[model samples]
Target: MSEAPSASPHTPLPAAVPPLTAPSVPPHASSALLASLAPLLHEWLPRQRWFAGKGRPVDRFTLVSATELMPLTGSPGLLHLLVRAHQPQTAPPSGSRGAPPPADCYQLLLGVRRSLPTSLASSLIGQVQDGPLSGHSVYEAMEDPRLATLLLERLRVPGPLGSLRFEKEPKADVQTGLAPRVLGLEQSNSSLVYGDTFILKIFRRLHPGANPDLELPLALAQEGCARVPEPVAWFEGANPDDPYEPYTLGLLQPFLREAQDGWQLALRHLADGRDFTDEAHALGRATAEVHTALAAALPTLSLGRPQTELLADQMTDRLDTAVQAVPALLPYAPGLRRAFDALRRLSSAGPAVSAQRVHGDLHLGQALRNGDGEWSVIDFEGEPAKSITERRRPQPVVRDVAGMLRSFDYAARTNQPWNPEWAQRCRAAYCEGYAAVSGTDPRTMPELLRAYETDKAVYEVLYEARHRPDWLAVPMAAVQRLATT
Candidate 1:
């Protein structure tokens, strides 16, 4: 992966603050509390959808930082934490066992109370066994209105609080004390909508640099792009050691309260025996506009022969690894190889292809439609499986087109009577709309499109096999079609 992506002026970097994880926040007390919560977290962390260490036992935990946002003696108290979970590596590099396994740091906002509330029973993380919070009940803070509102207050007034820094846009008007409620749909993160005016997404997994979810949107907002919701405010950790790096822990944006989830909308259209050509075409246009803004705001590069060869190598490598994971992909190996290999053959004859910041991991689910039928892309957080460095790397816009194309196929096959023709129409219309906006037809670069599409199917094969064995056939069908076609 390339070196970590830096934030542009649009993303105003917070000044370095003294490290709050140590020499402050009472390290000994926090450590003792963490030790007592270890077993409870070990039981709770793996069960969370946002927990990355799924299927692996959490060997132990180390409290990276802890701050009492509100004293536990209050009616509702808040504890902000950056905790690292150490889990056994499935396949550590040779000789790595001598050292402890790599740990993933997670941002946890916990609500503590003396007595358990019946209403918040679902958010419970169990009672503490020892330390200052020994008998206090702790639960997810995002679900509690008092704690969630307090979070917004932290964002409204921008400044350093210990190592944490809260920031808002140049003239952002952050309304205070809106009743807060967490959205239940998010998988990798938790979000709370305050009075239908603002939504704050609390990142579960902590990263050391600016997350694209906030990075790209902030840039787009500065560029006056309405196709995506503008990020209003966010909070992060400011470490003197990593002075320039902003460890983003959350994002705050205007809540699109009336907007419908793009995936659910598509499914509804399909169930009604309708095609999504019009919606898909509009969505393609929206995606193109976003790409245009990103390219202008961020850096863009041309993929010449060397980069093209590297792209082919990565696709081929993934295919090879995936084939091992799911033998079903073995038969289509040669066909998939042909798709990637053609990239090398095309690289020699054509002018260099354009590569720019793109919506990594784009799919129907990441889009939202307002009541006016306008499309707005959300969640620029790229692929969760990839490192932030890799996710922010520039890539061909066709990667996004391929993702949406694959999503259309998924919608078709999932329906009882597989509607291949409907998916085809939507795919074609989408490409046409994209061309209308960007004046570049993705189909012009046939090999690149096929390679990305083929790579996506290979990924799906492994994902479905591992997570949803019965649904494995859906992606396998795409693999066969993409391979033989």
Candidate 2:
């Protein structure tokens, strides 16, 4: 309700002493309410695009933390939460002691009211039959402009809203009360565009420690990389119960209104049977620039025999897993292993390469081409299927190149006639441009590049089989080529 203290630094609050008001956290009317919403959430969460643990059944819902942004006593109330979803252990990740860890913690923003309008029907979670507000209705808060605008204001002020911490960049001059609307994009996260000024990405799946999306962009911006948008403000879960634990919930950045989506642009070119060599070359140069900046800003390692062999082993393991899930990949498994074996052979020959923080999941969809024909990469969050720690790991630059190459193939296949020649041309041009800028050609390291591409294709096979069955043939086509040649 008041401006932040003048004495407070513009930088993010340290893990130590933090200044703020007493937030309306659990002591308020929310615990009973959370208990009431558990059943509703279990039903609704699985249907959403962003929910990570899809096929797994939710065992229970644990209220990790709750913050009443706007109490239900007011107009339309806003409740912020970090709830952990417990699910059956399938093939769980490493590092587990006594019991299995929680499936995932989600950052949910819900709008509470006594009635839901016809327009907000799509946003509905369900009417709460029991809670603090016994007869109240609830829906996604971000879909409501009033609640979304209120969120921006909280970030603008930069202070404590209970266990939730809203922070603004020191140099960022954020405006108050900008009109907000949801950005309609197929992503694992929800985004709100505020009057073409900024876009706020609310992470539906919450994780401890800094998210790579926020961390990588900040690192690149510091390196004076113009290929990524600078983060303006962000909010995190400031757990009063455990102040030491960190959780990045959302990120806000300046919106690029005039930039054309790279995926859409590629699809349009494919549909028209146009040559995309020039654009592909320029995009490759842009990718090189981002990679260069990331190397300059962060840590880099010399990956030798040990690393390469380990990488090859990892690829083989992933391929085995994929074959188990998608039986169509069974026949190609032996052929795919050749790529990994080649990488191992190269490693045995004493070929060493550089490893650094990469784009992790670079594709046509993750890039944007401005009106001036300049390329800007977006979403540094890495692969959606990976954990935060995995996303933060350094990998070979060719891994990113491999992803974009796969994307070119996807674009060509998605178009009616499946133009492999166009994809081949674009791939070559992209590598040429990259070599020109980075002083290293990924094509020169054919074995390593092929290994990464095969690894990615294997991942795609499993993902498509689980998520989009109709798109199974797309990656299977690539599998056929990679398996044989």
Candidate 3:
């Protein structure tokens, strides 16, 4: 698992191109084609891993936008769509049946063919019942090699497709015609690899802003940081009504072919029962390098007594919400607040804390190690649940340090024959490595680190309770340790 993270203060905002005004329907798209596909989408969407609303029945479908980039007369069709799926109302009163239920917008890349290729049978959504595509089989485009090739071709030659605009980085040399393969790992977004040269991440959830994933890494590359992959090409959508807010759809970057996942590497070291301090130290130094570069590239904020208090309030609020959802966290709520309370007092009496752009959701899984024994950081989208505004908010660098420290604990606890000392040694070594480069130790501010670590554990408790009930004990044990120790 590798993460992608964003932009500097001096980076110019993406210039707005005057909107492409034309007929509502793209030349190749038809209203009847969409009408036939709506029902099929309702049935197919809930089954896909990228679909957010699982375990809920779809009530209806609404078309937000649809562009037929390549039409099928005798060949297969390619459609790019943004559609809303309304969930069935479970708690609404009888009188409110007329009101529409809550809905979520999702992006779909569809490939329509008259006959199913045995290779693409598994990716089939369903056969269209009526209208223009009545006899065709529709499948996710990422699974069809031909459609995947089309996407890469578009990136290779940047141009517009209706409202969408594809642009290539000025200095990036994009080599196309490579075979595409979809990454099978479970993630918030879907990713496709084009041979060994490039990886394109297709965002499922759409937010109206410059995505930090694209913005941050491009900025770091500009800052001459080799610890991140170089961004090559990307696509964004602009609405004529609001040209200021562009929605980033996908990003293209150089693929690290020989890189090993940091999470798997840690597990291997633990399985072999070997010391990981050296690797941990290098990772810490890499983290520090990125942090230092980001501070210089982006605007830094100083958190005084008032802002610190607000931060404490947010921690307390998260704990309260977690208690309601997990119930098991209720007992540790008061003890956890002690950490935040200590932070409040420390910030009030002590000097102000420095805040800057950081990897908000840092963990071992978000890093990679190459054969040359160098570490690279990725995925700067922050917490997936947070809004774009929240993810972009500057915070103390200690938050990321705490996240990495907690991950070390996770590696020790989840692996058989738990050894606390292993994590302890690695944490100390990581902080030492960071301090050597940063000139300041993260452990100096014990209260802030403790508070952030506790907050992270609380979030894990809630996440495990909902997603992995059996693994819930990992965070529960951590909560007990943080509370008692």
lDDT per residue, candidate 2, 1-485, as tens digits? 22222111122322322234536555555568678998789899888889988789998887877777776675467888888888888755455367665468888999887777666778989988876767777899988776787777777878877777889889899886467889986558999998789999998887677889999999999999999999999988864455676788889999999999999999999888799999999999999999999999999988889888998998998898788778999899899999999999998785587899998999999999999999999999887667888898889999999999999999999999889999999999999999999999999989989999999999988989988999999999999999999
Best by lDDT: 2
Better model by lDDT, 2 or 3?
2
Query: What ranges in model 1 sit over 4 Å off?
Result: 1-24, 92-101, 239-241
User: Mind giving the per-residue lDDT tens digits that candidate 1 earns over 261-292?
Assistant: 88888889889998789998999899999999
Span of ten consecutive residues with least summed lDDT in model 2? 2-11
**lDDT at 405 for candidate 2?**
99
lDDT of 3 by residue, 235-344 (tens): 88764336887778899988888999998999999999999999999999999999999998899989999999999988988898788888888788888889989988
> Which has the higher lDDT value, candidate number 1 or candidate number 2?
2
Query: For candidate 3, what is the TM-score?
Result: 0.90
